[model samples]
Target chain A: MDWPTFIQSISNAVILGSIYATVAVGLALAFGVMQMANFAHGEFFMAGAYVVYVFYAIGGMPFPAAVLSAFPIVAALGIVTERFIFRPTRGNVLAGFMATAGVAFVLQVIVGQVWGVGLMRSVPTPYMGAAEILGAKVSWQRLLILPATVTMVGGLWFFLHKVRLGKGLRACAQDVEAASLQGININKMTALSMAISGGFAGIAGALMAPINAVTPYMGHSIIVTAFIVVIVGGMASIEGSILAAFILGFIHTFVTTIFDAVLATMVGVAFMAVILVVKPSGLLGRARV
Target chain B: MKYLAALAGLAGFILLPHFIGEYYVEIMILFMINLILASSFRLITTVGDWSLSHIVFMGVGAYTTALLAKYLGWPFWGTVLIGGMASAAVGLAVVFPLLRTKGFGFFIGSFALGEFIRLIWVKFHFPFGGPRGMIGIPSIELGDIDFYEATPYYYLVFIFTVLCQVVLYRIDLSRTGRVLKAIYADEDLSKCIGINVARYRAMAFSVSAFFAGIAGVLLAHRLGAIDPKNFDVNTMVYLVIWVVVGGVGTFWGPIIGVAIMMVIGEAARPLAEWRPLLFGGILIVFLTLLPGGLENLILRFKEMLEKLRSAGESQPAE
Candidate 1:
């Protein structure tokens, strides 16, 4: 590959990694806190994109504001899911995940019904130009993703380490009974995990709306990759998700560039399968009883 | 009395396609196919691992027969058995690496692995046709009877269903069934008792895939075409909903679940767009409110009736 093309692919990989991290961190958090894996997480991402589409594209609101709006909107959806589905199905991870699948179906249908599932919604690119960086012409919109992801992921890290509630989620993830014994409100922690999970996934989706085709079933492609990321990262490790996301992002981008998207996905899944077989606990994940 | 009930029910089912019209008969055939798929799924759950790939195995079976019959001029009966074996081989490959993890990891791993296989079809346009899928698959031709006719196809599916159900039922009733149940109940204890957990898990998966492949053979012939989209995660979710809504505890649960849901499915056919939402709602309700499923309700009602009968018997004796 030419140096410019190689540099461009690297930029693409970085942008993709940022998006994957943003989408996967919440999944790790939710899985960590309450053992709840939201199969509807990709739907939450799709909903975020739709939120941006409805507000910025259709309503002609400011693009930044529409993207900001996705966080709370999809976060609320996440909390509602936690309240109804996860809470009732708590302690049984499999059942809870399966039920979230129903949530996935409902969200897809509702979105399809409202938006008309026939064609992908085209959100006009609010940022239209490209930026030259390191001899590579990267689109300004794609360039923006790296900073946004760093900010969001950095903010999340600061909160988890410094904030009181964030520590409580960590506490709960470590030992539910012990955390409860320490006077932590398990419900609050779980709700918090899901809220953040939904919000981050939403932001990722909202940001990508213009770049990708927006459809109700768009979640199908993403959810598979997200699950692969989560599994490879370690089921409940936040940092592991971040690491795995970038690794997978590189794998996916380069492989896709080299061969094709289908083969890249096949390679990604195979990579995950290998990780699963080798280290069931994941790359950085500590084994839990 | 039990024998008479069984015989009469069998006769009624055999004569069902004669009375029903072509469309409903077709639906019944699809229903039987799903029954086999769902029951095979339940078999995997017995070992405490739920696979998201049973339908893909069925797809493998379908593709096998489709390709074999389309090009190789293989007959229906011969290809059906070969389909099962092919699926079983694929099942082992899927489950072997998966043996390292248990519970949720295994579940997601199986899904990833299954998606990998499905993607192979999507990625490849050769022998396995691409996304548009294969069409004009030759119909099943048995001696003296063209199975393309609805009645003949119905009877064909009926025999497959009955045969598969009987074999699966026997497996569930055998000592092997007891061992599988024990594995689910207490894996640690079962291992302590000399039960080979890993071997049984793999065995259960392959066996389940074998039947799933058989269903695939039935479906491929019935549809007279096959596509990669026919076996995907969306279809897997429906299978999960069926087994979950049916409850996986008993032999009758999936059958009962498929029957009730299929009825709702057919009746709500006019509202094509909203059907997924409806089924999705039902799944949430059953998973949340009736986790054990309709089968649990039936079992509880049966227990209540038994209690009342015993109470009446004691009162009369006194």
Candidate 2:
């Protein structure tokens, strides 16, 4: 491959990795805080895509406004799901799983009813034109994703490290009852986690809407990939997920460029299998539950 | 009374072909296949871990049988057994590492393994037919007769289904079953009590994979073809739902759940795209309201009816 192509491939890998990092980090946050898997996390991503599709594509709202609007809309949905479905199913892991799985199906069906099944929606790019970076041509849209993801991750780190509520969230994640004793309302922390997690996923979805085929079934592949990433990174480890995402992102992109997308997926999965066999807890996964 | 009930159920199954229409018979055959899959899923759950890859085991069995029958010209019966054994062997290979993980970790791990297998199936076209799927799998032949229609195949599936259920039921009620239940209840306690938790869990997974293999083989024949899509995550989700809604801890929960859910799925066919919505709604309701599942609900009703009858008898003196 030429230098420009190589540079482009690296940039593509970074962009893809950033998207995965954003989505997987949300999952890590939710799992870290609640000890719940949130099977509907991908649906939240899908909801974000639809939010943008509705506002920017159909409703003619400005792209920035549509993207901003998706955060709160999907976050509210996440809060509702946590309060009604997850809260009631607490203490029963299987019940939580079933309810979340049910929620995923419900979201898919609703999206299908609104958008029609098997039809992909087209979302025009908000900002058009390419930028040159190290002799490689990069689309502004793809370039924006990297900084946006970085900002989100950096902001999240700040929130978790510097904010009191963030400390309370961590405390709840460590031990819910202990956190409660410290006057940190466990329910509120969980709700906050869901909202932030959902909002993060939604933002990722909105950013990728122009590039990806927006369909109800879009979440299926995305969720599977996210699950693989999350598991390979360690379920509750945000840093691990970020690192794993970049690794997987490069693996997938390089393989796809060299061979084909189908082979790339196979390679990615094979990589996961090998990792699982060697380290079941994942790359940075804690040995504890 | 239990024996009588079993006998009646068996008799009804045996004579089902004579009474039902071809279409309904096909449905029953499909139900029987799902019953095996669901029950096998429950078998794994007995060990305190649920596998989402159960359907992939079925896929393994199906592809094994299909490839052998289609390419090597092997007899269907021989290929089915070979397929099932292949699935079981794969189970044995992965069970040790897999059982090491607990709870949701194990679940996700197994699912990833399943996805890996599927990707291989999709990537390698010569052997497994890749995405287009394998077609023209020869039907089983029984001495101058071909069991291609719904009736004969229904009987074949019914017999295998009963055999699998009986074996699983025996295991569930045996000492091994007790050990598995103990593991489920408290793994650490079971380990302290001298039970090799990993060994028993592996055994449970192997047995479950074996039955899932059988179901896959039957499903491949029933559909007359096998596709990568047939054993994907959606099927895995449905199998999990069946096991959960039927009552995972109970021996007969999967049977009831598979029957009811498949029937409902078929009945809701007219709804078309709305079928999934209806299905999801029903599943959510069941998860929230009947966490113990349909089997538990039936048990409670039976207990209440017995109490009412006893009250009526005692009121005679009053």
Best by lDDT: 1
Residue A27 miss distance in model 1 (angstroms): 0.3
DockQ of 1: 0.72
- Candidate 1 interface RMSD, angstroms, 1 decimal: 1.4
Q: How close is candidate 2 to the true structure, as a TM-score?
A: 0.96
lDDT by candidate, in order shown: 0.92, 0.85
Superposed by TM-score, candidate 2 places the C-alpha of residue A105 at a distance from the truth, in angstroms, of 1.0
Could you tell me the TM-score of chain B in model 2? 0.95
List ranges where model 2 is wrong by over 4 Å: A287-289, B306-318
Model 1: per-residue Cα lDDT over A1-289, one tens digit each: 8899899899899999999999999899999998998999999999999999999999999999999999999999999999999999998988899999999999999999998999889999999999998999989888889999999999999999999988998899899999999999999889989999999999999999999899998887888889889889898998999999999999999999889998999999999999999999988788630
If you score just chain A, what TM-score does every candidate get? 0.98, 0.95
Pairs clashing within candidate 1: none
Q: Write the per-residue lDDT of candidate 1 for residues B1-318, one digit (tens) a residue.
A: 999998998999898988888999999999999999999899999889988778899999999999899989999889999999999999999999999988888888898899899888888888788777778889987688998899888888888899999999999999999899999999999999999999999999999999999999999988998898899989999999888888999999999999998999999999899889998899999988888999998999999999999999899788
State the displacement of the C-alpha of residue B150, model 2, in Å, after optimal TM-score superposition. 1.5
